[model samples]
Target chain A: MSESNTPRLPLLRFVYDGLRQMVRGRVVYWSWIGLLLAGILVGGWAYIQQLQHGLVVTNLTNQVSWGFYIANFTFLVGVAAAAVMIAIPAYIFHRQDIKNIVLMGDTMAIAAVTMAILFVVADLGRPDRIWHMIPYIGNFNFPASLLAWDVVVLNGYLLLNLGISFYIIGCHYRGCEPKLKLYFPFVVLAIFWAIGIHTVTAFLFSANVGRGFWHHAILAPRFIASAFCSGPALMILGLQIIRRVSNYPIHQSVIDHLAIIMTVALQITLFFVVAELFTEFYNETEAVMSAHYLFVGLNGHDQLVPWIWTGLGMLAIATFIGTVHPLRRNLLLLNVAAVLTVIGVWIEKGMGFIIPGFVPTPIGEIYEYMPNLNEVLISLGIWSIGLLLFTLMAKAAIPIECGALRAPGIPAGKLICRPEQQAPEYRKEPVNGESES
Target chain B: MTRYAMVIDTRLCIGCGDCVVACKNENRVPAGLNRDWVVERTSGAWPRLETEFRSERCNHCDHATCVQACPTGASHHWGDTNVVLVNPDQCTGCKACIAACPYDARYITPEGYIDKCTFCHHRVEQGLDPACVATCPTRCMHFGRLDDPRSRVAQLLRERNGETLKPETGNLPNVYYLK
Candidate 1:
C-alpha cells in the first residue's frame, strides 16, 4: 500500500472518535443543560407573574394588543417553514449531501413550533382559559377562523413530524431502511403544513378588510417569500455550527448551494416588499396614508422609521454578502450574513409587520406602544427555551449523522465501537503532526 | 326590524369625548378600553392648521371580516338587529378578530373575549338610542333605523353626502359620516 494512502480510519471510527471527545469534555453538555434549566425556571416564574397580574405586565396597551409574544410567534413560524426548503432538495431532488442534513430541518421545525405555542400561551390574557379553543367543550370556529385553523395545523404538523422523525430514528437504530412508502405521504403533508402555518398567519393580518394596508391579496405571497429566505438562512447557520462543534463533515458545496437558495428567496422577498410599498405609497387614499405614516414616519411616531430603515439596510447587506464571491464561502461572513437576514426579517415582519397597520389608528390617532421589561424578559425566556430545545435535539441527531450511530445490517457489536465514538474527539485534536492511522 | 345605523356631522363634532364616556358607562367597559372613541386630526401647518374630529365604533359591517376571522365563532352579528356581539364564554382570546378588524374597533377584554361596540343592542331592544347618540351634547351623532325610511339616519344619508369608513374595503359599514 502507498504510504500516503495508509488505511485511513473507517468512517465508523471517525464518528466514535468525535463522541469521545465531546463526552470527555462534559462541561459543554452540562452547561447547556444548566442554561436550559435556568431558562425554564425564569420563564416559569415570569409566567406565574403574568398569570397573577394579567396582561397589564406586558407592554401591550389598548393601542398595541400584540407585543413581543406575537412577534416571536411570527418569527418562529418562519423558522419552521425553512424545513420545506431542505426537504425539497433532499426528498424531491434526492440530493445525497442533503440527506444527512434533512433531519436537522425537521428537528428545527419541532423546536420552532414549540416556541410558537409558547408565545401563544404568553400572549394569552387569561392563560387558564386557553382550553376554550377545544372542539366540543369550547366552540372551535372552524374553517372560518384562521387562528383556529392555525391551532389545528400547527399541532398536527408538530405531531406528524414527531411521528415521522421517531419512526426514521427507530429504523436507523434497528438497522432497517426507512419505509419510504409509509413516510412519503407525511412528507407531502409537512410541505403543505409548512405553507399552512405562514399562510394562515398572513391571513390573520390581511383579512382585516377595514385596514386597507392589510387588505391585499399579495400578503400571503409576501409571507411565503419571507419564510423561505429566513428559514434556510437559519438552517445553513445551524448546519455550519454542527460541522464545527461536532466532527460531522458537511461539504462546502452544500453551504454554497444553501446560500444560493437564500439569495433567491431574499430577492423574491424584497420584490414583494417593494411591490407592497408601491401599492401603499402610490395610492393617495386616507387609509393607505396611515400605513405610509407608520412606515415613512409622517406622524409623531418616528421610532418605527429607524427600525424600518435598519431592517432594509440589513436585508441589503445580507443579500449583497450572500450573493458576493468568497464572502459567501467564508463561514464567519456567511453566518453573519445569514443571522443578519434572519434578524432583519424578524424586525421587518415581527414589529413592522403588525404595528404599522394599527398606526394612524383606524380612527387616525397615533398611539405609540413600547414593550416593558417584563415583556422583554418573557420574550428572552421563550427564545432561550427554543435554543435549548434545538440544542438537545441537535445532540441526539448529530451522533446519528456522524455515523457514530449505526444503521440496520451492521452487527450491533461492531456498530458500538465504530467511528461514531471517535470522530468528535479526533476532530478537536490539531491535525498538524498527527499521523493518519 | 331595527337596522341600527349612526350618522355624524364632522362640523358639529367638537372633540369633547362625551360620546366615549357615555358609551363606557353604558356598557361598563373597563378602564383603558373604549367601546366608542373619537379620533382628532390636526393637519396643515402654522396659521392654516385645521383640526377635525371623527367619532367611531363598530360599523356592524354587512360583510364583517371579524366574524369570519373569529376561530371560536365568538364574534357574530345579532340576527335582524344590526348589532355585532362577541361571546366571552366561547372566546379563547386569540385576537384574530382584533387583527382582522380594519376599524381598530375590536379589543381584547381582560376576560379574554373580543369586545367591541354593540350599538347598545340591549337598549335598542328596549326602544332606546345608544348612549353615545343620546348623550351627544351637540347632537352631532344621530342614531336610528336605516331600514325605516322615515328615521333620521336614513334621511341624513339621503340628504347629505355621507361616507362610510373604508368603503373600498367592501365591508358595507352601517355607520356614516357627514362632512
Candidate 2:
C-alpha cells in the first residue's frame, strides 16, 4: 500500500463496484439467472442420488464403463480450447473490433475450463479421492499416464486465462491500458496453452490402445479441427446474444472473423472424417470393428449409426451455408449455421465418439450403454453452473470494459454507469468533479 | 523372480462353469458382476464349425496398459510377482485402467474402486491353488510360477505351445490357453 493522496483501498472499491454491478440487472437478467439456478437445484439433487447409490445409479457397466459424463467432458474441453481463436487475432494481429470483445473470449474460457474440471469430477466413481491425483500429496503417475498430463495442462490453461483476463480487466477498471510487458508474454503463452489443453484431452482418449476406435493418430487433429468448428460456433451465438441484450458494442467484424475460422475448420474436420472412414473401411480388419458399429452396424446393432449420420448431415449443411458468402454474411443464416455446428459437434464428439469405443468390447461382445436420468440431470446441472459462471464474468467484464465502473481514484474518465445500473449511489460521477471525501 | 501364470487346457476342459462359481464364492464378487467369465467362441463355416468354451480372466500382462494408464498409480504392479492390483485407498475410480485393459478384465466395484482378478495371490501365498483352480471339475486350469522350469505351467507352455489372447496387442500376457 503506497501512501497516496487518493481515497482508501482502491482494490476494495474495485471489488465493491464489480459486486454491485452483478446484483443490479433487469427482470430478463434475473429470469435467466433464475432458470440456471433451478437447473442447479435439480442437478445437485440428482448428483446426491448418484453419491448414495454409487455409479450403479447410472447405466454404465463393466462392458461400457465410461459413459455420458465422460463424453460431455470430452466435448467441453474443445469449447474451452476454442477461446484461442478469438485471442490470436485480437491480441496478436491487433484487430480493434475483436480486441473490444477479446475479454469475452477469455471470460468464456474461464467458465469453460471450470466446467471441464467439474465434469471430470462428476465422472469419477469416488470424487472424494480426487486429491489422490495431485502430484506431491498423492501418488500421481506422471509421464506414463496421459490422464496425469491432461490434469496438469487443463489446470495450467485455466490459471493462464484467469491471470490474463484479470490483469486486462483490472487495468480497464483503473482507467488505464494494461502494460504489454507485464501481460503480453502471458497472453502469448495462453495461445499455445489453449492448443495444448485440447490436444492433451484428445490424447486422454487416444492413449487407450485397447479402445481401437479412439486409438488412431488422427484423433488429435480431429479434436483441434472440431474445436475450431464448435468453439467458434458457440462464440458466434453467445456474441449475438450479448449484442442484443447489452449496451456493450460487439462489432459485426467479430462475427465475420469467427464465421471464417469455423468455415475452414469445418472443411478440414470433414476431410479428417473422410480420412478416418477410408482408414476404417478400406482394408477392413478386426481393428476397425468399432467403426463398423459406428458407421453402419455390426451384427444387428445400429444404435449409433443414426446419430453419427445426423451429426455429419448437420456439419455438412453448416459448412454449405458458411461457404456461401451471402448466406454466411446474413445474420440469420450465420446464427443458424452456428446453432447447427454447436449441436452437431456435441453429438459427434460427445456420446457418439465416447460410447462406440466401449460398445463392442475388446474380445467382440456388444454391450450397449444408455445413460439414465441421473446422468442427464447431473450433466444439465454442470452446464447450468458453467452458463451461470460465464454470465457473472461477462456481466462484470462488460461494464468494466465499457468504463461504467472503475477504481474511484483514477483521474481519467467519468464513472458513467450503464442504463441498467440505476442504483442511487452509482449515479454517474463527473470526470471534472473532485473525488469523494 | 516368480512370475505366476494361468494355463487352461481347452482339450480336457468341459464347459462346466465351476471356475466361475468358485471365483464368485472365493472373492464374493457382486451378484451381477464377475471377476472371471466363460466365453463360448464358435468360428469357421457351418459344416466346419469349431467351437471352444474359454474361461477368461485377467491376463496379468508384463506390459500392463492398466498400470500405465492409471493416473494415481492405484492400478499398479505388485512387487516381485508383478501381478497387477488396484490400491483402493489411492484409487480415484477414474476408470482409465478399465479402458486400457485389452482383455476387458477390470470392473468398477460396488464400493467405487476398480476390481479385477488378482490370480489369487492371497491363497497362493499359503501354498494352495486358487479356489477356481482347486474346484475345476476337469482339472483343466493350472496356476504356477513360470520362472521355475519344473512347474507344470512352464512345462505345458513348452510342450503345447499355448497361445495368449490378442497377442497382436503386444500386452505379453502371462495367462496361456492350450488348444
Candidate 3:
C-alpha cells in the first residue's frame, strides 16, 4: 500500500475508506444502527404530522412556545461545549493519553452541535424560513439579537470542530506527524470557541429582561460549570463503549482525568445553584414568582416540583460519588455517576431552567406544559440521529488513530513518522486490526 | 415624531371586553386567540375587594424587546407611525419576541408567523383610531401621538396618575393605565 508523507491528503480515498470502515462491524453494531434507524423512522412520521398540523400537534402553546425541542437543543449545546474537557488536557496540558482520544471529543462535539441545530430546526414554527436569518442571504439582525449571536457562534463552533477533526484524522491517515504549527492555532481558537458557544446560549436566556427567572448574571457561569460535568460524563460512558466494541485504546488515566474534571465542575455547578437560589429566596420579592413556582408551588400549580428535585438529587448523589477518591476510581461507580450527571443536567439545565422562566409568565399567568406524543417522538428521533452520527464517526476514526487504517500502501498497525513510543495508546496494535479485518 | 400611544382610564372601564372583541375582528386573530384581553385584578382580603379591569395588549414600547430579540428584522418599528409590527414575510417564527415580551404579547399564528397587536397600523394609516380605542363602550380608551402634547393620550397622561404594566422592566411602554 502507498502511504505518503506529502502534506496534501488524498481526500477522495480517505472518504471512501472511512465509508467502508463504518459498515465493517458485527451484529452488535448492526443492531445498534438498526435501532437508531427505527427511532428516526417513527420520529420522521411524527415530524410529518407536526409539519402538516403546524406546531399545534405539540403541547407547546403561545404561552410556552419553546419546550421539548429547545430543551434538547440547550442540553446538546452543553454536550458540544464539553469537548473542551478533552481538548484542554490533550493539547494545552500535553497529556498523551488525553491527546490519543481528543479526536473522539471533536467527534462528540460535531455530532452534538449537529443535533443541537437539528433540534432548533425541529422547534421552529416555520423552519423552512430559517434562511431569513441567514447572514448574507437573509436579513440577519446581527449585533442586536442574542438568537442571531447564537446562530453565528454555534455555526462557527461546528465549522471549527469539523476543520479540526478533518485535519487531525487526515494527518494520521497520510502516515505523518500532525505538526503543531499547522494545527495548534486552530486548536487554541476551538477551546475558547467551545466556551463561547455555551456562554452565548446562557446569555440568550439571561439577556431577556422580560423573564425574571432567567434574567440573572449567574446563569452564564452556571451554564459553563454544568456543561463541564455533563459533557465529560457523556464522554466517559462513550469512551468505555468504544474501548469495548473497537480497538480504540481508552486508558484509565483518560477516564480518571475526565472524572476528576467533572467532579470539580459538579461542585462548582452546585455552588452556582445555591448562590442563585439564595438570591431568589432571600427577600421573597415579586421577582421570585417563577423560582417559587419551580421550588414549591405558585397558586396551586406544583407540576414542576418533582422534576427539579429529581435533577438535584441525581446531581448531588453523583457529586458525592465523584468526591470520594475510592468511589471515583471504581469504574462501575464512575459509570453510575456519569449516567446520573447526564440525566441530572438534562432535567436541571433543560426544562428546569427554560420552563420555569415561562411558567409564571411575565403577566403573572400560570400555564403549565408537558411535551405531547409528537414532541416526545420527534425528540427521540433527533437523539437517535445524533447517536447514529456519533457511532459512525467513532467507527471510522478509531481505526485511523490506532494506525489500523492508513493510505492504501501503509501497513496496518504501522505509523510511519509519528513521534516514537508516545504512550500506551501508541503501542503496537495487532496486525490486520479487527476493524480493518 | 408621531409616537402612537394608548391611555386606558381604568377608573371608567367596566370590564365589558368590547375592546378585546373589536381587536379580534379587526386583526382576524386566529380562533381561540386574542390580540388584547381584559385583566380583572382584585387585591386585598375578601371583606374589602379592590378590583381594576385593565384591557391589556402589546405595549409597542419605545425600547421594544421583541425588536431587539428577533434574529430576523421581521419585528420592526412601522415607519414614522412609531407603531411596532411583525412582517410575516421576514419572520422565521423563532419566537424570541414571545420570550422577550413581558406582557406575553406575541403568539404564532397558524400561518407560522408571529402575530400580535399591531396597534391596528393598517387602520391607523387612514388616520383612524385603533379598533379597540374606537370600540370601547365606556369611552375609557384614547389613542394619539405621544409626541404631540395636544393629543388626547398625551393630555390624559399629563392630567391623570397613569401607570404602565411592568414599568420596572424599562420597556418604556406606550400603553398607560389611568387608575
Candidate 4:
C-alpha cells in the first residue's frame, strides 16, 4: 500500500471513490432507497399519463391555471434559499457549532433546488418545449419576465451550492483546510443569492397585478421570513435524523439556537400574514374576494378554509413551543415544533399562497381547484427523486466529513495542501483509497 | 399604423351568447374553455334589482402583461396592429402569461399551448370583421382601427361614454365597453 504523506488521485477517481461508499449502507438505508425508488416509478408512470393526455389530467383549469405543482415549486425554492440561514452564521459570523453541519444545509439546498426544478417541469403543459426558455439558443426574455429571472437564479444558486459543498467535502476528503479566500466570496454571494431565489419567486407572483392576493409588496419579505423559519426547522429535523441514524455529532445548543431563529422568523411571518389579512379585510374591494376565499368562504366555495386555519393553528403552536426555552431544549418537543413549523409553512406558503390568488379569478369567477390523483402522484415522484438525491449526497458527504473515508494517501486528521496547489508527484499516487477497504 | 380596437355596446347587447358561440366556432376553442363569455352582474335589494350583461374577452392591452411575462416571446403584440397573439410554436406552456394577464383571458389549449381571443386577426388581415363583430345579432359589437377617425368604433367612442374594464390595472386595454 502506498503510505506516502501526500496522496493524489484524478477528479473522476475521487468521485468514483465517494460514490462507491454511497451504495454500501445498512439494510435500513437500502429499504429507504427502495421506497424512494418505488415513489419515483409510480410518479414517472403518472407523468407519462399526463404527457399522453395534456394538462387536462390535473385539476387545473382556465380559471385556476396554476395548482399544486407551482405551489410546491414556490415552497421548495424557499427551502433551497433557506441554506443561507446556516451559511450566514457559520461562515460570516464564525459560529463553530454550525460549521461542521453547514455542508448538510448545502446538501439540503441542492436537493431542494432539484425538486423545485422538477416541480416546474411537472407543472408545465408542454415540458418538452422547456428548452425555449434557455438563453441564447432559445429566445430568453430576460429582465422583463420574472420567470426568466427565476430560471437564471434557480440554476445559478444550484450550481453555486453544488460547487461550494463539493469543494468543501472534497477538501475534507483530501485532508486539507479549504482555502477561505476561494469560498468566502462565494458564501457571501450565496447568502444574497439565496435571498434572491425566494425574492424573485415572490416577484414572479407579485409582479402579476392580476392576482390581488399576491400583488402586495409585503409578499417577498414574508416569503423570506417564512423560509428562514421553515428551512432551519427542516435542517434541525434532518440533523436530528442523521445524529440518530449515524454517529454524526449534533449539539443540543445548535438545535436550540436554530429553534430560536425559527421562532423569530415564524413570528415575523405571522406579523406579515396579519398585515396582509388586515389589508384585505379592512376595506372590502373587488380584489378582496380571493382573500375572502382563503380566510372565509367566498360565494359558497370553502375548500381552502380548513387548510389555512390548520396552518395558522400549527404556526401558533409551533411559535409557542419554540418560545419557551425549556420546551426548545427538549429534543422531542423541539423536533415536534420543527415538524409543525414545516407543515404550517408548507401549507401557508404552498397551497395557501398560490390558490387564493386564483380563487375569485381576475374576471370575478369562482372555479375551485384541487389536485387530482395524477398531479399528486407526479408531485410525489418529483419529491422522491429529490429525497433520493439528498440521501445519496448525505451518504457520500457525511462519511467524508466524519473522517470515515478519505482521499488516496490522505490519512484522517492529517492536513495537506489544497487539491489544486498539490505538487505534481501527489497526482501520480494510486487511485484506490480507504473507501475501497 | 392601424391600432385595431373593439367597442362593445353593452346597452345594446341582449346577452343571447351568439357572440360567444361565434367566437368558439371561429377560434376552434376547445370544449370547457372560452375565448369570450357574457357576464351578468346583478345588484341592489330584492325589490329594486338591476342586472347588466357584458360580454368579455381578451383586452389585448397596449401594455400587455402576457407579452412581458412570456419567457420565450410566445405571447407578443401582432406587428403594428397591437393585438396580443400567442405563437404556439414558440410557447413553452409555462403559463407565466396566464398568471400575468389581469383579464383571465388566456388558457392552455388541449395541444399544450396558450390560446386566447386574437381579435380574429386572420379575418381582420383579410379585410373582414372579427367573427364576433360580424355575428352579433344586435350589431352591438363594433371593430375598427382606433387611430382612424372615420372608423365606426372611433365615432361610437366619440358619441358614447366608453370605459375599459379594470382601468385601475393600468393595462390600457384596446377594448372598450359602451354602457
State which candidate, 1 or 2, has the greater DockQ.
2
Name the 10 consecutive residues with the lowest summed lDDT in model 1 chain A: A413-422
lDDT of 2 at A426: 18
* Tens digits of per-residue lDDT for model 1, A9-97: 53455345435444543676678768877877787788777878778677776666776788788888888877754687778877776
Which segments of candidate 1 are over 4 A away from where they belong?
Answer: A1-25, A282-295, A400-410, A413-437, B9-18, B39-54, B136-142, B149-152, B155-161
lDDT of 4 at B168: 85
Worst lDDT run of 10 residues, candidate 2 chain A, spans: A425-434
**Model 3, CA-based lDDT:** 0.88
lDDT, candidate 1, residue A337?
Answer: 87
Tens digits of per-residue lDDT for model 4, A255-318: 6668888999989988999888888899887788888999898878999999999999999999
Taken over the whole model, the C-alpha lDDT of each candidate is 0.76, 0.86, 0.88, 0.86
lDDT of 2 by residue, A8-107 (tens): 7767877787888888888999999999999999999999998898888999988898889888888889998887656887866777878877788888
lDDT of 4 by residue, B1-179 (tens): 56888999988888999999999898888898889989998889999998888889999898888999998888988997689999898898899998999998998999999999999999998999999999999999999999999999999999999999988887889889998
Candidate 3 residue A315 Cα shift, in angstroms, is 0.6
Q: What are the RMSD figures for all models against the true structure?
A: 7.2, 5.8, 4.7, 7.0
Query: Candidate 4, chain A: TM-score?
Result: 0.92
Candidate 1 residues B98-170, lDDT tens each? 7677788888777656788998888887989889999999999999888999999899989999988878777
What TM-score does each prediction get for chain A alone? 0.87, 0.93, 0.93, 0.92
How does each model score on TM-score? 0.86, 0.94, 0.94, 0.94
